[model samples]
Each structure stands twice: as C-alpha cells, then as structure tokens.
Target chain A: MTTSFEDFAAGQVTPLLRYATVLTGDPHLAQDVVQECLLRAQQRWARIGGLDAPGAYLKRMVTNEFLSWRRRFKVHSTLTGIDPPTPDPAGRYDERDAMLRRIARLPRKQKAAVVLRFYEGYDDAEIAAVLGCTQGTVRSHISRALSTLRAADRVKEAL
Target chain B: MNTEDLIRDALRRQADLAPPPGPVLAALHRPRRRRKPLYLVLATAGTAAVVAIAATTFSRPTADAPPAGSNRPPFSTVTGSPSPTGVPSGKLVSLEYAPTWLPDGFVEWRRSLFDHGWQRTWRQAPPDHSPSAPALTFEITRGSIGSLLESADEPANRTTVNGAPGVYTDDGLRWQVADKLVLTVNLDNVPDARGTIRRIAESVRPDRRQIRVPVSFGGSTRFTVSANSRDDWTASTDVSYRDGRYMAMLHSVAHVGSSPRTVTALGREASYEEAGGGVLTIPLAPDRFLSVGGLGLSGFQQPVPVETLTEVAALVEVDLGVDLSWLGV
Candidate 1:
C-alpha cells in the first residue's frame, strides 16, 4: 500500500530539510525552500503517490526550487549572495578546510555541480540531469569550479 | 585523501552544522485549497490523512525494502539505487608526458593542473635565465577533447602523428589523440622547441596506468532522466537521447491554443507545427496529450527531428518521475 501524504511527509521531511540545508548552505533558507516545495508537493499528492519513486520525485522538486529561487522569488532584491563560510588563517589549516571555504564561495550552479559530483557521488550524466544541461557542459562546469578551488593549494605551497 | 573524499567529509560536516529540524516538523500543515474537490472525499483526503500519520517519525523513509512487485528496489537515505548514471568507480588514468629530449641546462620544474588537463613545465638554467627565461609547457586535457569546436581564427596547419590528427605551429604542436584525449604544447619563449614538441606529440602513446573504459560515443552522448514536477498541475519530461547532442522535451497539455497538422507517429495520430520552436503533440489519453518542444534549435542546441520525437513518444514506457498521465485531464 502507498503511504499517505502525512506519513510520507512526516517520514521524509527531515531528510528533505537536511538536503536543502546542504544545498542552500543556510539552514533558514533550507527550511524555507523545503517548506515551500512541500506545500506545493502536497497539492499533487495523488499523482505523486502513484509514482515509482515518490521520494526521489520530491527531492528533485526541492532541488529545482533551490536552483530557481533567484528567479522565482525575486530574491535578489534583498539578498546579494549567500554568505560563505569564513576561511581560517592559511598557515594553520590544511588544504581540506581551505578547499571547503573555496567550495562555499563557488557560484550557485558551479557549487551545485561540484557538490553533486564530489559529495553526492554523481557522474557527469547524472549531474547534467540534475542541473539541467549537457554532460559536456557539466564536465566543463565541474572542471572550471575545481580548478578555482585548487588556487588555495598554490598559495599554500608558495608559503 | 583525494578531493572526492575530502569534499564528502566537508559536506557532511556542514550538514551537521544545521540546527535541529524539530520546529519545521511541528509546523507541517497542508495549505488550504481555493478550489474545493467536487466530492468532499477528495477535498479532505490529505488533511483527513494527517491524523493517521501522527505516529510516524521524521527519520529515514526508505530504510526498509519496498514490498515485492514494486519496480523500484530497496532504497536508503542515500540516493536511489536504480539511477543508471553510475559514477566511474574505476580510477582515472593519471600520466604525465615528459619530452625525451630537453635543452641542456633545462630542469624539470613544475607539474600542475592546467586548463581542463595537466601540464608539465621545464625552465632553463639560471645562467640562461634573464628577465625572459625560456621554458617548455605541455598541456594535456583529458575530458571531452573531441567536442572542441574548430576555431576559424587559428591559421592552424593540419598535422598527424601515429594516425591521430593534430595541428602544428612553428612554436609547438597540438593533437586530438584517439578522439578521447587532447594534447597541446606551447613553447613559452623557449628556442628550438619545435622538434622536441613534435617528437613528444608523436611519441605519445596510450598509457597502461591511465583510467581506461571501453571508449564509445553511443552512450556518452545520450541521457535519460525523469523530471520532477515544479508543481502538481504541470507535468513534463526531457529525453536527451543523444545526451547533450539532442534533447526532446514533452509537456502535458489538453490542447494547443493554435491549430496544427495531424500526422501518424508510430501509427498513432499526432500533430506538429514546424515553425517557432516547433511543437509536436500526440494524444496519449482522452483529453491528455504529450506536447514535445525544443525543435528546430540551432547551434549547440541539437534540433529534434520530427521522426525522433515520434519515436520518443512511441517508445515511452513509463511516467518517469512526475506522472504525466494525470496531467491536463
């Protein structure tokens, strides 16, 4: 039997929130994105309930919502950009922590692509599907993004 | 540790920084609908179901195996298992190509990542080093090299090495090896580097240590993914049958505002208009049809041939993620 809407929501909302947090890099924004998407999702519960992978379906919605937030909500009026995690003193920290800061500073699509590639363990094709572009484009975006993050290493080595 | 492992750890740590979601759970109330369902049963089914879901915990949903007969396999908090887009588990080949011959007093100085690939540099001895020092740099790009659109500006000379086509310049040489790799050499102020660059380019052979996969174009250029509905009413799917090369999108609609010509697609009646981002609509169920768009797209955007669109409609087996069958009804 298919799980009811509330049961599905109750069971799945936390993970959705968590994924959103990681995606948006802000817990509050993550909550907003997830809540809004879920509100929209509840309206289509019937069609969604019959789907083979309802959770996957919902996750994709949240992802799109997060990706398109700038256009959909006119968010640019108030918020210029998401605040990046603060970098530590370069000499004290290793590449991993430094890379983490550089990662947080990546542009939205680039950040999303990198996260999907490295953190989510998705391939170029999968990432292209998620981010809505060609695999070649995904490869280009990932390659460019990672190259920027490596700049910190060059600085570290020079020191 | 590699970049992948380090990134995974960092992300998980960032995820840990998120405050508890307990408040969000307590506030999970369905929005009120403006249009009441024809039957009271419909209007209240969702709110009606909330009481039953009260005991459910906001933990992992796909922890257990789904009941048998389900097309989907068991899932976890991780990504779905059925995703065909598998990340390459096999190691990528990492090999550096160094020229067999270098100018006397030249020392191998740097090996680092270059644009879309790797590069190795050799700087001349300090006695030869002035404000302008001669150096040799070889860049080998490993990803999607064959797709590089030929440029009109380069007065590039066509050249080949070992049957692989390349371009040669006075200063250096460039090669697109085996359609899977690209190697370009630039003589950055280095004198008498042409002969060495050509030798290195010609001597370059497939490496055993490099990550190897059966190279094929049929699969790499194609992709299939289930689209998630932006909302309940709108339903759509895009099939990149040739991956990035060609893309076809189908949106659910009952009918179009303008008229169209009817044609047979896979023996079923279909309608298509060829002008202005061409659209082909095929009747799937009564009052519900799949409208395919993204036709006649030029440049990098592959035009979806009408026959390909028909074939896609004919071959569609299941509603990928968002069930389009219920749309536009």
Candidate 2:
C-alpha cells in the first residue's frame, strides 16, 4: 500500500516546511509553499506515495513553489535609502550581519542557489534537481552570486 | 571568514530560528491550498506526483521518455530479491548484463525502479579495506542522454569503458547500453576507481528481469491496475479498478478547495468532496487531498456511488515511512 498524503505530510511537514522556510527565507511563506505543495502532493499521492524518496519529490515541489512564490509574490519590502548613522571612527559594523543582509538581498534564483549549495550542502546536480534547472545554470547562479558577495567584501576591506 | 563559511553560519542560525516544529505543522492545517487557483505547482523529494485536468491518453511505460540511443540502453535492477524459489523478477526492467563479479564485501545497498520511463539505480557497499565513503553507486536511466548531458556541470569526454563506447566525466562513467537505456557508475573513493568501474561495466551481460507489484483488493472493490508509478517511495498509481460494469477510477493526491465529506476510507479519516459528483476529492492534509476525477468518477451518464470511491480508496494501502532528519526534529 502506498502512503496516504496525510501520513506523508504529518511525517514530513516539519522538514519540508523548514526547507521551505529557508528557501523562501520567511516562516509564513514557507508555510504557504508547504501547504501548496502538500495539496498538490495529495492530488498525486497515488503516483508519488511509493517513490523511495518522496521527501525529495516534495522538496522539489517546495522549490518550484518557492520559485513561483518569488515570481508571483516578489517581496518589495526593502529598506531603501535608509542611511545608517555614521559609524564612530573606531566602530566596526558587524561583518557577519552585513554579509547576511547582503545575502538576503540577492535575487531569488541566486539566493536559492546559495542556500541550497552552502546551507544545505547539496552538490550542483542535487541543487539543480531541487531548483529544476540545468546543473550548468546552477553553477553560473552560484558563481555570479558569490562574485557579487565577494565584491561587496572587497569594497568593505578597501574602506 | 570565507563567503561560503559565512553564508553557511548565517543560514544555519536563521534555520535554527525557524518557529517551532509544532507551529509549522499547525500552520499547514489551516486552509489555503483550496483557495489559491494557479497553474504549474510542482516540486520534488523522491517523486512529486502532479495532478492536472488535461485529457492525457494513458500510454504504457512512457512514450515521452527520450529515446535512449540504440547501443546503450539504461538499467533498472528489479526491486526485491527473488522469492528464493524463482529467478529475480521486476517490472518493466531488462538488464542487458549483470556483473559476472563484484569486489569482495560489496553488497547491495538499495535498488529503485522508476515507472516514468522506469529508470533504475543500484548501490553497493564500498569495497572492503577502503577508507572514506561516497560509496560506489550505479544509476541507470532510460530516455534521452541529452537530459543527462544537459544536467552535467562539467563537459563529458568521449571515451569507452571496457570497450563499450561511453562518455567519461567528473560526474561518472556514463554509457547507453541499449536503446533508450543509459547506465552510470558513481565511484566516489576506491583505488583506481575508474579502472574497477570499467571492469565492472565490462562484466555486465544482458540478463533481463521483469517484476510487477501485485495488487489484490477484496469485496466489490476489485479492480485492475494501470498507470502506477514504480518509484517505490509513494508507489502512487492511477488505478481504474472495475467491478464488471461498475468502475472506480482513482489516483492519489491532496485537496484543492471547497468543504469535504469525511469518510473512514481505508481506516483513515478521508475527507471527500465531489463537484457535480464528477470529481471526488479526498483530503490528505489541511489543503491537500487525493482526487478521483475524469469521466469515470464524474457520473457523466450515471452518478458514481460514493461507495465505489470509498471502496477504491480502501483498496489502496497507504503504508509508508516518513523521514524528517532534515527538519532536525
């Protein structure tokens, strides 16, 4: 007997949502993606209920939903033009927090590539599988994203 | 710190900040999927069964599976060992060859057969005396090598393993053994791993096996099986079981929208919904459900009894294990 979608969700909903949360970088949105995916998964439970790695399948679903989430519900909540107080001559900004802020500001695909590659430790092929793109595309996404991040660091160090 | 390390640390901290697991689960139980109306919602773990209303004619095996080149077909080892009395049999699998030999201490780890063009994968324990992991794994996919080539992060080098024409890459050794069948060996760490890989490739011979997951349902719920996925995780299938003239056509899935009629289907709380009684939706989660739709369930000519749908759901066994290791829960 194949697993019911409910069982799969009850068992997998946590990681699936967590993966979605990080992938989307928002708790509410992660819940939305997981719910959407589970609803879709329930529709195909018969076909997918028996795969060896249903979680992998659902993760991919979450990823696709995430990409769609980006396209359909692009967040425009940037704090534009809000200049911070001048740093006291001896005061250094928290580099880690700055790096993370920049990372969060990355475009959706690049951010996804970063999270999947570095945070999740998935290889290029696996990341591509999750993001539904060619492995080469994943490489370029990472390369461009890392380059941008590195450029930011270089500018800070020069200052 | 390096960018990667920094990103990893920040992300991990953020992940740790994920609002408790119990909340995550509770939030999904809230209604939403039923309200959103959009096209193209797809994702994956092992197999993400997608449901659409397109009138797709059922094709045996997969016709869209890109044709594996004539010379090298893919490999899918039959699942499960033989019953100890008969030869190893699996569904829709034809092994062109089995290694006449394997390195000592190498044992079968797992085997998977996919029904969508039915790709196969087999892994064996690392050869004894080898330190480190990324064990030797074999993957056989049926369809176009173009998809494989397209997904490759590195370019493939045209070469032959064991005199069999194939492509070599940092990815692994890939070659199509028969028409529409491509085989690959992922050797992570071993002495002269490539050489041993080639030897193993050479030893494989055509010893095809076919096995099918048997299905049996009791009572008036009897039906034949079709359009079933062999991917092992969910084994999600599209079975249109017929009880003589009375037929029940159902596939597994989650809910979309509208209220539901609850039933104890197959010993679980099945939330059932019908649209004009043409479509039957069985809720699996808050926003997820399995739908039995099409001309059969719709009662186009005659209203399909809810009893038929319930029986069909009952016949399906939903036995599965879910892993949340990634969730850290």
Candidate 3:
C-alpha cells in the first residue's frame, strides 16, 4: 500500500521540527528547513512512501539541511561573551540554561552529533548514517563537544 | 547532574520550542510563489565577451595532453567572465574544475560554493529525497588532500587519474589536481563503480561560469566581499575588513530569534543583539531578512559599533522576486 504524503507529514512533522529546533537553536529556521524538506519529499512520495522507514529518511533530510544551512548562511559570531542566565534571588544560576547556550555555540556537526546522541538516543552508527560520515567521525564530533562543555564547566566553577 | 543527564534534560526542554506544525502544513498546500529569473546573461558584453574569446582561443587540445588512461595531471588554467560590477565572479567565484561528462542517467542535483572551494553532487534520479540516498559527489579544496588514506579501513592502492597520481581506497579517489588544489570523487551504490569513477575523474575540466546569487553586496570597498550560495537558492555575501576585526553578512533568509530587541535601521525596524557581536537583522520580506554585524577576532578588540552595522545594512541590495522553487520545500 502506498502511504500518502499528507499522512506521512502529519505523523512526522512534530518530531522532525523538534529535532531541527534543537539542532539549529532557532525555531523559525527549523520551520523553514523542515517545510522545505517536506515539500521536496512530497514531490517524490511514490518512491519515498514505499520505504520501510520513511520517517528516518525525513529525519536525515532535516539533519543534512541544518548542516548545509550553516554554510549557506555563513553567520559568524564569537564565543567569548555568551551571557549567563539570570541568577535567582538566592544567588543560584540555571546551569541547564547555560549549557543550552554553550550547546548553541558549538560547531555545526558537533552540535548535531550531541543532539542526536542525547535527544534522539541514537548510537554512533545511526548518527553516522544520518550525517553521511563514518562512525569514527561521529564519535570524534561528540567527544570534542563533550570536552568543550566540560572545559566550560570547569571555568564556571573557578569563576 | 552528570553532563550526559544535563545534556539530555537541556535538549528535552529545548524541544518544546518547536512551533506547532499547523502553519507548515498549511503552507504546503498554498500555491508556491513564482518569480522571474534574477540572473542577467550578458553573453556579448563586458567580461562575458572576454570569456567567450578565451574559450574559443583555448578550444584546441594542448600538444602535451596526456593520452587516455595515462596517469598525469590534465588540468589547465581557464579564465571565465567577470561580473559587470568588477566584483570577483566566474572562475574566481565558482568551482575551479568540473566533470565534463558523467555516466548516463546521472544528473547534477546540488552544488555549494564557498570562500575557498566548491562541492557538486549528482544522482541517478531526482526523487531520492533521502540524504543517505546513493549519489556521486565531486569536491575541490584549496589546500592539501591531506592523507588520502586517513579514513581507509583497508590499505589504499596507488592509482592514476588522467595521468595524475591518485589514491584509491574503499572510501573514494583523491588526487592533487594542482599545486594548491585537491579533488576527491566519491561514489556510492553506483553500477560499475571503479570504471565509472575513473571515467568521471578523467573528464574533469576547467569550469569558469559565475554562480548566480539572489542577493548582491555593494556595501563598502574597504571590506572584501566573499559570496556563497547553496542549491536551495539561499545565498549570502560576507564582507570583512582586511584586519578581520569587523565584518557584516547579508543573507537571503530571515534568522530572527524570539523576543528580539528592536531598533531602527535604514528607516525600518530591525531586530538587534549586542552579545558576542552586534547583530542587526532587518526584514526584507515576510520570509527574507538581511543581517549585518561583525565581531573582533582578537581578545582585546571590540565588536563593530551598532551605528556602523546600521550603515552597512543600508548598502545591501536584495531581489525578492528570484525563483526559489529549487529549495524543494
């Protein structure tokens, strides 16, 4: 049976959009990217609908779109002045918020790898397929991201 | 919490930021906007004429051309037409080399131009929407090929491409096409892979056509402009000072964040941010925005002032009517 594009998009758009949002750190851009990918997917639904896991294919498309979007946009910013989240009246800070900001500043592939592992619960092999890279490269990206985050945590503690 | 737990928690929280899918679904059914092509083909004028003359003069094969299946470098420098504005265009802005032929049924589907080099991909069918779908990709870089066998699980075999030394591994073929240029061709799930890859690599020649972009940067002569474009039709031109302390980027897509602080620029309201670097985003249309800002590369240097960014933003020219159907979504 050939599944319809509308039905596929109905079931998959939420997860795809959520994944893109975390990957891009910008919801509006995520929407644009997801919508673009879906539109293309619709044009080729006859073949795509026949796949065993169409959602996985769409997810990979979103990941690739975010990766290429960074290159096309080419917006460069420094990492020096990322402001910490507001402190509570008790003088405590939200470390999660700070971590999110740091994640936002990671290089594109690293951030995507981190998101795929932590959010999607994807193994290195799965992430590798989505990224169109080797499993070793995927591990390297995640390891580098963790190192940067840990180093940032240490600096915060010292401060 | 441990870093892993913290990352998981943070990502879960961030996932809520995804907007509801109603609008996206609605947009899918709406009629797509149609626009005339923005590219101006002045084939008989200015740099186009020069390119035409050069191409004709260089049409004959060089006497030293390597024989078929010979292992030698087959590339010769070819000049392309320049943009009318004297902005670097054509060979200066496009890929240095492109395959003159491909196996039957292969079609060029995507190309990305960057500051240093470009990448082009071809596939057997257009309907393969999955990113992991089988395709052939050709990439050129401005630096060393850098350990062609670095990622090879098996020992790489030394080979030749058009008489030039190359390394062939399970992953792909890599060769130094020129002193500063390296080329790699990757094949995935293609029929007769080895012979096809060799034939495609051997057919590479100088391609000097200027890539068309949806927007142009006329900002300042003091800043050198580096333009890049993607197959999706989204393009950007980044202008930076020689010292790299200040820069501005103009994109054909809007990148506004939530609850952005608003200010005035170019007689219109714009979203502004001073953190990391001063960023001024002015909406060009419902779907497009222009961003202009730069940060200091050195620790002691400060970001460009907001006023300067506003001035730079004023100098951008955008074409809202450019056809964007290729964006796929």
Candidate 4:
C-alpha cells in the first residue's frame, strides 16, 4: 500500500525545511519555500513517493521557489547607500553585518551559487543539481558573486 | 580575509545557525483525491525505484573489478555453482545485487513477483544457514541496458571516476562517475549493510572492476578480500561464505568525513522503509542487530521457517560475527 502524505510529511518535511532555510536565509521566507515545495510534492506524491531520492526533488523545488521569489519581488539591482555605521572600533559584528549587507546586495543567482557552494558545502556538481543548471553555470555564478563582493567599497574598508 | 575562506566560514556558520521556520510537515500533507495528474505520478514513482536500483546496479561487480579499458576479463574465476537439490528451481527471477547483506532478524516478504524484473523463488531460507542474511534480493532480466535506464530518468549529473564514466541516479540527486567505479556510502543506515555493500563493491574493484561479489560452493572453499578505509575505520568489506564458514575478510573505507566514533554515533538510528503495512528499522549498533523478528505472530506465510531462520542466524553469528540481539525467536 502507498504511504499516506501525512506519514511522508512526518518523515521528510523537516529535512526540506532545513534545506529551505539554507536556500532562502530567512526563516519566514524559508517557510514559504518549504510550504510551496510541500504543496508541489504533495500534489504529486504518488510519483515522488517512488523516487529513490525525493529529497533531491524537494531541494530543486525549494531552490526554484527562492529564485522565483526574488524575480517576483524585483529585489535584485536595487542599490542602497552603505550608511556609515555608529563608530565602534571593537565591534567586529558591525563588519560582519556590513559584509552580510554587501552579500545581500549581490544578484540572486550569484547569491544562490555562493550560498549553495560555500554555505551548504555542496560540491560544484551538487550546487548545479540544486540550482538546476550546469556545473559551469554554477562556477560562473560563484565567480561573478565574488567579483561583486570585492567591488563593494564598504566590504573592503571593514576588512 | 580571502573571499573563498570568508565564504566558507560564512557558509559553515549558516549551517550552524538556527534554521528558518519554513514549511511544516503538517502544512505539506494534503489529502488525497486532490492529487496531481497521472503523468507526474508515473514519472515520479518510476524515477525513485528505478534510480536507486540503477545507482547500485550499474557499477563494477566488486571494488577489484578490472579498471576501465583494462581489456582484462573482469571475472577471476567461473564460480557460478549449480543449485543444490531441493533448492527452488525457477527462472533467476529478481536479483537485487546489493553489496551489503540484510541485518539479522530482518525477513523479506515472500510475495508473487510481477513486473520490476522480479521472479519468484524458494521462500524458505537455507536449511543449514536458515535465517540467512544479510538478506539480499536480486532479479535478472533479458532486456538491454537501455531498457533498465529508461525505467529511470537520466542521472542528475555526470562525472569522470578513474577515467571511466558511470551514470548514477540515487534518491533524488543524479550523476555519473567516470574513469573508476564509484561506491556510494550513505553512512545513514544499518552499519552492517553499509559496510557489507561497501566491501562487496570494493572486493571486485581492482581487476574485476564490478561491485557484485560472486559466491560459489567449490572444493575447499577459498575466497579473497579487498578493503579501503581511513586511518580510523573501514567502510566496506568482502568475505566468502561456504560450508557454513567465512573464508576471507576484505574491508575498505569510502569517504573520509568524520572519525569512527562520529560515524558509529551517526550510525545509531534506524532508517526505515515502509514494508508489509509496517515500518522496518534496522538499528546500527552492535553488529547483527535485530530489524524485525518473531514473525510467528506477525502473519507470515505458513511452515514458518522459524527453525531455519534461527539456524541461519546462528551461522551468521559464527561466521560473520553478527550480534543477533534476542529477537523473541
């Protein structure tokens, strides 16, 4: 007999959520990604249920959702002035925040590539699998993202 | 700081950071009757089973299988032994070429084989080795390799392993290894199965180049072992079983991610597959742990081979050192 979606949820959802968090970086946003992925998987569990690695499907869904969310919001290409932080010599946390802000400023694909490769510790091929692109594309994203991070004057000053 | 290093640290910290609150399982589970289209269902179901099976199947028979393009006959010995008397004689139905063995106390449901390249065979365990394990299931087919590959989708990605290319699809992620045969060590299930699978795959790695460990009852049963492990622990081992005895032991380590203690601890919990209206969890501690037993009450086929199973369990223990926990035999 086929396993119920409820049982599948109990067995598989948390791993997806954990993965979503890595993808979106916002727990709330990750929730949306996870929810959307779940809905998609549920609508087609009969097929996914039989897959050797349903987890991979869920991952692809989450990554795609995150990318789509970015496009829908048109959040990329928006520039913000790096406000001079309140002076604190020892609070390296400010530097971290500045760096995060800079990373946040990168284009969506590049950010995803960086997050997937460095944050998730996925190899180039895994990053490609998650991103639904080729390994060369994944490398390109990483390369472009590093360039953007390097060009951010605030990041350099903080370093 | 270098961007790569910072990126690495940032990513590590991200993994450590509290994960965001995303979709809950409760929210994901939708009632049936609202399911998606038929093609999706077929596509998905077809992908899962076919991918995992293919992932394990298409590799070298053993770790020592001849390297790619070596032009050497991968088979070291023609060891296909004839079936013994009283042995179930039928089509070589389904054969799951799993390098690993099943944990003690785990019983395969004997049911009618239909599609999925499965054929029915003797339901009873070996008389002398009753309760045989690690329980493995395999099926052979007369179709072309493409027929099997088509059963599943193309692998997720392709790579070269030791100058050979291997198409791989497992769980969800798909990839191909080139150059050399690749052994997938999940490190997330029963240690015995994991170790056995690794060992079996590695045994034929060299000249044999296949992951399938061939066994045959011959004169004065002799066998070989091949292994690869980190400085701490090995991941795979191969041994020959004949005349209720183990002839050789081969061991190997796959990926070097953590220490043995970490791996041992990681291997504790049981990852289950839904079977027979219940879940089967194979524990990973104290080798030969019980998976499910006492089938006398669990509604098994008649002529319950309780005695045979027990005998197999004992033989496994004596030969393989499997610690079959008291499973209410």
Provide the TM-score of chain A alone for each candidate, in the order shown.
0.76, 0.80, 0.87, 0.75
- The TM-score obtained for chain B by all candidates, in the order given, is 0.31, 0.37, 0.48, 0.19
Worst lDDT run of 10 residues, candidate 3 chain B, spans B40-49
Model 3 native-contact share:
0.35
lDDT of 2 by residue, A1-159 (tens): 776454455456645655665665544345446766776777788888989878889888777665664333332111111112233354322444455557766888898899888877889999998888999999999999999999988988899
Please identify model 3 stretches exceeding 4 Å from their true place: A1-159, B1-94, B123-129, B132-134, B150-156, B169-171, B189-192, B210-232, B237-312, B317-329
What lDDT score belongs to each candidate, Candidate 1 first?
0.44, 0.44, 0.54, 0.33
Lowest-sum lDDT 10-residue window in model 4 chain B = B42-51
lDDT of 3 by residue, B8-49 (tens): 988876764453343354445434312211110000100000
What are the models' TM-scores?
Answer: 0.35, 0.36, 0.41, 0.35
lDDT, candidate 3, A83-104, per-residue tens = 2223446432356656786787
RMSD of each: 25.1, 20.1, 16.4, 24.3
Cand. 4 Cα-lDDT: 0.33
Best by TM-score: 3
Which CAPRI category fits model 2? incorrect
Q: For residues B257-314, what per-residue lDDT tens digits would candidate 2 score against the true structure?
A: 2335565543345454332232344433232234332222111133345456554444
Q: Which predicted model would earn the best DockQ?
A: 3
Candidate 2 off by > 4 Å: A76-93, B27-329
Error of 1 at A45 (Å): 0.8
Q: lDDT (0-100) at residue B296 of candidate 1?
A: 16
